[model samples]
Target chain A: MGLEIINTLILLLLVVAALVALRVKDLITASVVFGVYSFLMCLLWAEMGAVDVAFTEATVGAGISTVVLVATIFNLKRKSSD
Target chain B: MKNTSLIPVVLVGFLLFYASTDFPEWGDPQSPASSSPVSSHFIAKTGVDTEVPNMVTAVLADYRGFDTMLETVVVFIAGMAVLAILRNFSRKKPVKRGHEVSVEPDLIVTNTVRLVVPVIQIFSFYVLAHGHVSPGGGFQGGVLMGASFILIALSWDLERALTRFPINRCMVVAALGILLYAGIGVLSMALGGEFLDYAELEKVLPVSREMARYHAMLGVEIGVGFTVTAIMFALYANLSSRGRLEGGL
Candidate 1:
């Protein structure tokens, strides 16, 4: 019951995060928001008892992917795009 | 928001939300995935065969070793492909951009990294070595290990990170990791069993078949960890530096 409610909340947050990440003109800001999106998805997976998947998500999605995105952004100084 | 696009997005969202009602409740024992024969077989015999508490690792590294081996190769191929593309392009045609000044690592960031990097590397090894009982294994551990190097790059510079783990050396280590995996498969085959049949490793190791499988799985996981760690840092190095292998983000 409470768990289901929390799941719904997280899912709602995920949708908002995705939308914001998509609509943002600044790619770097979008990357950071996508990191938030990944972390929320990780939490959702953890709540669903997929701890291994969640762990992978936490590390790869939130940790390494963020670094890669930031590094890529360094190459492109003009962060904003169409 | 524009009405046209907003309508489609909202409609799709509502449809998906409505559809979710028919899905199985969380942790449903009768869920198709949980009730499947393959899952049941793994649950029943994973302990008997591999003596591994973590069935995910046992199944991934032992029961389905071939697929994981191919997956490691895929990671390696990705690193190599990036190298081929970026390294050659830089050599053929050099592109110049506006002036960008290099900045020194922040005092706080460098100091914090100095304190944390050791712990992170140790934790990565723990995740790799303890996967038999824990929720972590090669891929996750490898990512953590790679991140430790990346942290160094972030706090200091790419040159400092490359000094510790050079690009050429990373490639060697990556290949060696794949070799370690394929070598185990070949060894098992030589011991009169099919490829990747870890139970046959008992002939070489002073352990029972089950224990041999357990130990072999650990080795294979380590191989995977090596490849993933190397490829990850390699990718960061090449991409961030535009294959110049000098200045980086």
Candidate 2:
């Protein structure tokens, strides 16, 4: 029962993070929020017992993807279309 | 635009939540994925056939060795693709213009990286070699290993990191890793077994057939580790630098 509540909360946060990442005007902040979304998803997967997948998500999503996205944004003008 | 986007987002989220209700309960031992004969077969026989404690590693590096080999090559190819696209652009511009805009490496970041790098590298190898008993394997270990070099790149400057693991050397190591994997496959074939049949390794090795598969999986994981580490830095160096090989973000 406790696990169910935690899972729902995490899922909610994941949605919120994704929405904020989309809504944000700053590309860099959006990308960082995307990282947060990745992290939360990893946590959810870990909680579900897919430790291998969670590890990959933590490394790729939270670590490398953030770096790549940030670096890609650094080369662009900082403004968002919205 | 924001409101329009929000409608679809909320709709999608709602649908996803609704759909997730159909998924089996968490930790359901009888879930289709875990309850299938294929998984059960692996669980039952992986220990007897390979003598490796970790079923995932045995399945990945032994039963599905060919697939893993190709996956490693794919990583190497991604590094090369990034280099191909970004390298020339960086080279055309003067390198000095890069440093003018780049900040000097902060003392704290550099010091922390210096302290953490050795430990990270050690852990990467442990993850790679210990796949027979742990949750880690080639891909995970490789990513961790690559991240170590990337940490060097991140905390300091790209140049300092590159100096430690140069771009040319990175490519060579990446290619060699895949080669090592294929070489083992070909060796197994030559030893009167099918490709990637690690048990065939017992012909040349002193260990029993079961132990040969166990040790061979370790070698395969290490090869994966080498490729992943090299390409990881290579991708970071290229993408961050826009191929100029200096003053990477």
Candidate 3:
């Protein structure tokens, strides 16, 4: 029962983070929020007992991909035009 | 306009959530996936066949090795595609952005990174080698390893990081990783077994058949680690420098 509540909270945060990432005009902020979303996803995977998947998501999704996205954005405009 | 778009998006989102109600309860023993004969076979015999306590690792590096091998190749290809598109090999100067400020590497950040980089590298190695017993493997370990180099770049500059791991050597390491994976598979085949049949390696190694699979899985993981670590750094280096391999963020 406790686990269910924690899962629900994390899921809610995940949805909020996803919406913020998509809605934000600043690409850098979006990427960082996307990192938060990835970390939340990692947490979700861990809670589901898929530790391997969670570890992968933490490293690849949250860690490396954020840096990669930031690096790419540096070469372009930082703000969303639309 | 955005409000109109939101309606369909919300509808689809709800539809997807409603559809997900059909999925079996988490970890349900009676679920179709859990009750499948293939799952039972793996759960029952993975220990006996590979002598690996971590069934996920055994299944990934041994049973589905071909899929993982191709996945590594896919990573390599993706890195290459990015490089092909973004790498500016010409000697042209990078356009200066108005907001760019040339700043020296901070003492505190560099000092902290100096202290942390080795620990991260060591931990990555532990994750890679110990993945057989734990919840990590090549991809996670390799990403961690690559991030260490990236940390160096972030703390100092791309040149400093590139000095330690140059792009040319990065490519070599990435290719060698793929070669190592395929070589192991071919070696097992040459030993009178089907491709990727790690049990055949027992004739060469002193270990029993089960141990052979275990050790072979380790070798495969190492190959995966090598490719992932190199490509990760390479991707960052190229993307950050816009392929000029010069001054970068």
Query: How does chain A of every candidate compare to the true chain A by TM-score?
Result: 0.89, 0.88, 0.88
Give the chain B TM-score achieved by candidate 2.
Answer: 0.87
Candidate 3 segments whose C-alpha is farther than 4 A from its true place: A78-82, B1-15, B93-100
lDDT by residue for model 3 (B87-155), tens = 887776667655456679999999999999999999999999998999898888899999999999999
DockQ-based CAPRI category assigned to the predicted complex of candidate 3: medium
**Cα distance off (Å), candidate 1, residue B211:** 0.7
Which residue pairs come into collision in candidate 1?
none
User: What does candidate 1's lDDT look like per residue over B34-83, in tens digits?
Assistant: 89999999999999989999998888899888999999999999999999
Show the lowest summed lDDT stretch of 10 residues, model 1 chain B: B90-99
The CA lDDT at B203 in model 3 is 96
**In lDDT terms, how accurate is model 1?**
0.90
What's the distance in Å from true for residue B237, model 1? 0.7
Between candidates 1 and 2, name the one with more favorable lDDT: 1
DockQ of 3: 0.56
Indicate the residue-level lDDT of B237 in model 3. 95
Residue pairs whose backbone atoms clash in candidate 3: none
Cα lDDT tens digits, model 2, A13-40, are 9999988998899889999999999999
